[model samples]
Target: MRSGAPIPDFGEAQLRAVLDAIPARVALIDRGGRCRYANRELAEFVGLTPETALGRTVTEMLGEAAGVLLAGQGGRALDGETVRWAGWLPFHNRAERRYVQRILLPHRGADGTVDGYFIFSRDLTELVESERRLLETGAQLRGSEALSSAIVASALDAVVVMDEAGLVMEWNPAAERTFGYARHSAIGRPVAELIVPPMMRRRHVDGMRRYMETGIGTVIGHRVEVEATRADGSIFPCELAITEARLPGRRLFTAHLRDLTEQRAAAAEIEGQRTRLHHVEKLSAMGSLLAGVAHELNNPLAILLAQATLLRDQATTPELRRRAERIHAAAERSGRIVKSFLAIARQEAPRRTLVRLAAVVDAAVELTAYGARSAGIAVDVTHDPDLPPVQGDGDLLGQVVANLLVNAQQALQDRPEPRRISVWTRRAGEGAVVVVADNGGGVPADLKSRIFEPYFTTKPAGAGTGIGLAICRSIVGAHGGRVELEDVPDGGARFLVWLPCEAAVEPAEAATPDRADESLAVLVVDDEPDVAESLAEILEIQGHRVTVRESGQAALAAARRTRFDIVFADLRMPGMDGIALRRTLMAEQPQVGARTVLVTGDTVLGASTARARRDGALVLEKPFTPSDVRTALEQALMKRDPPAS
Candidate 1:
């Protein structure tokens, strides 16, 4: 194992070249761990030449730190075991670190006893740093994936991922809550079947197919408001946005679904408020016009009746007297029609009571049957004698019934001589059902759906207001009922009103007796001259002495001058509103304020604002009738003086 340590590969010169070309440090060590030889690069790296490095200890060549690290392995190799190890090593000349990967194999003698060892070592700092960076990159990627998964799972909007086939692949917790489907149930399930309504299922499938084929979906990448069915088979509005993903290996689509049910409901409520406000404005104007006409007509009718009575009393012949009576009768009938028009046009708050359904239908028929017969249409009426009463406003219900009858009459106007209208009542699942059928030209098939929608009508613009059926729907809905229209079996339109049956509860007589019939001094205040005068007239008829004032200030001044038994004040007035008037009265004359009744054309005054409910003052909506006024006065009087209680 001297300088002539025979090299194995091709020849001594070639072996030296191979050893020099090699990147690792090569050395020959004996049992003493001395370098019998060293590669040129290793010699040069350690600032030693081959001639200077021959037959030297590795500890003297490399330095103390590297020497200590390799000494044990060198000993192990000389003991006939191969040694391999890796570790950090410090530069011999500079304050820096390097990693070394080393291997030691024993060289054998002719008798197979260990002679010395050949050692190999390479710097692994760059490779190790590369691997470290790779590991750090992997950890960062995993962390990013985890954060993304957490975000997707915790997203408020339902995150649903589907494959090319539209089967749900990822169903997050939000998706589960939104669609009422658990992940286990939803995974691998068709999203269409799970959440699409049956009617839209075909469209959904076709859209997906189209997208798959053309690489475009009409709804893809677009946010759309659509109705989605839930697990419970209930439908609601949702905003859905779908995005395509070109991830590795497979194509997928992700859908973000946000439940817009509450938002839509709120929007619908706003629309409803606007519609109601419009209706109120329209009705208020109509009511005023009708009221004025009715007032003017009533004065003439009263004069005609008075004159007719006088003429009848002084007539010399029976024919003349009968002619006078006929004129009187015609005038009264026209006045009644005017009154009915006024009643229907006014937006009176419903007075729910155990209304006799049979009586209402009978009265509606009586009012409209003659007109139908005159129009050459036969009328038929059927009723279930045992049909129970329903809880609703009698006048409003009557109006609803009348509207049906009138509509039926109008439908029959253009029909042949054999046209007939059928009205019937029956029981339906703990409910009372009233059906008005007309054998005239039935409603057009396309118009059936829109008939109940507000402002939708088939009649000429001048003939139809377009809100009759809408009003019917509103009124029936208010009474816990539904109005359904169906085509009659024999070719006609049948309108059915289904109202929940309620047993008539005989109203208990109020413990407070009627003090309204008794004489009482009352104040009537309204900015409208007609309203004040009409109210005073109605009060005078009820045996109450009334004083009329056109302003809240005047009313208040009048109240202070005289302690009125009951004060009726219009809510909206020029000088002061009824609310202000009441506050002042409460502070100045609390007794009179207690007896005050507020009349308002604004329906919201008593309900919408905190002030209204807080005030809690007795309120009567305007366009009120004589009875509404009398009833309000009676209630005020009764409150002022309870009988024997």
Candidate 2:
């Protein structure tokens, strides 16, 4: 045989070379379904040589089923049609062992007649098994993504997703509910414009842009509270949390929002209630102060009147005149005390003006001198000559200073040593300062801190109203100042009040001298006989015709009988109060009612002074001077026709 020629290839060398060269197993079959030729691999698989396998029917070598399948495929090829089949075939050498396979390409003659089939079979079991596993894994990944999306959709807090450019990518159902916008409307809109408040819209847009450009965030990755505008044109507060993430080539942000409107409203309501309670406590404190002031006034008035009556019965002498002058002074001091108490309890509109601090202190000291003398306390005054004036209600500040003097005197009443109260005025930085110091046992350590608190007092129950210092503090505070208690190194308590002073000097009001009073009939009504008598005497001395009635009912009856120019009636009389009497008189005799002047020593009457004024009547606070009484009587008389004889 030639070197490259086809060998008469029953030789093992040629067979082995052909088998190795073929990519697949190649076998040849005989007419009886027996193996006539086999490649090296096929022969090895069957555990037989080509010579041993030749002319051996497949049914004799392997199984009947294997033989039948081989014969059927070969017969189809022989009919001049290319045939291919794949199935499980039994191995000749292995008993009852099968291999899965596929066969390819049959051989046919050029005359269009089949000669025999050339078969190539391959094992494909592992490839089919690998494909099954891949399909299962793909299904599981899809299921996980679906479950995650479902969870996000069902959340209660508003969830919004945005692209790097701040355009809304996804808006969940919760977002729709919170922002009052439908998911469809929000999905394609810019998130900043849709959800951010108008005031914050520009900032939000800039922040998002900066974060996208430079990864510097103003709000991203942080939770914050902000106001959001809703579709209804109302604004609601909300808490927002933003988180940034990357998906593919795009950056995304997710925001979670929670509404805080109800919470904020609840907090504001609670604060309002607390403020109301504080006012109620303040009023209760005022009630106590009123009682203390009434008691303080009554004590001096009783003594002064008793002394005056005794002096009136004595023989005329310089000493007697001096004693009578002292009594009159005491009575005047008591009158001032009542007036100050009425002013504090009354919620009168402030009459603000620039006032001298030194003058106020001096007036307070003079007014409380009699009481301080009675209490055996000496008052010393220290004033800064160059102290600046303060803008405030002069009467109220004077009342504050008076209250401090009285308190200081009372605190030192029982001390064994000579008790001394000092009134000091000075300029402190840009403000005016008034200091009232007393050489009392000093404020108790436990009570010092609470001295300015309303309703807090060291005096026994029913003695002090606890509101004096509180009112003082409030008045000073209203003038843009502060009141505080400090330790007096000389073993006493010092109360210092600082008030902001006017930067420039103000011109003083021109003083007007009092004119001689024209005689006018005045009716004085009071439950206390002495109060009525004292008022009648004061009015009579002022050159006014005066008549005294002990009750509101008597005043009304007296007004009906006599055409008096003015009816001065006490407010808290029994049977009929001053308000009721005025209404009755108005209904019965309109002219007389119009001239009705309501007067009361009770501080409570201050509360209704405005209403009384609105009703076209003059209101005179009790414990007034003869001058005040004369002025009110003149005003009332001027409004009325002269009394008919």
Which candidate's lDDT is highest?
A: 1
Candidate 2 lDDT over residue span 392-437, tens digit each: 8988899889989889988898888788988889888988889999
Model 1, 1-645: lDDT tens digits are 544443332234645665676666878787767777787978887888976887677778878888887787877887899887767888676478887767787876534678788777767576445434433543467435454455567666788878988898778898889889998999999999999999999999998899888887778876567999989999999877686766556776778787877655543543444354445556667767765565445434434544454465567898998997787566556655555554565445677888878878876786676798789888888989888888888778888999999998898898887988888888888999999998877888888889998667789746776779999999999999999998766788899999998965777876644565788999988887766776676677667888999898888788888988888887767769888888898788777777788875444212322254357677765445555666777677665432232
- Per model, how many backbone clashes are there? 0, 0
lDDT of 1: 0.74
lDDT (C-alpha, whole model) for all candidates = 0.74, 0.69
How high a TM-score does candidate 2 get?
0.42
Clashing pairs in 1: none
Worst 10 residues of 2 by lDDT: 1-10
Give candidate 1's error at residue 144 in angstroms. Answer: 49
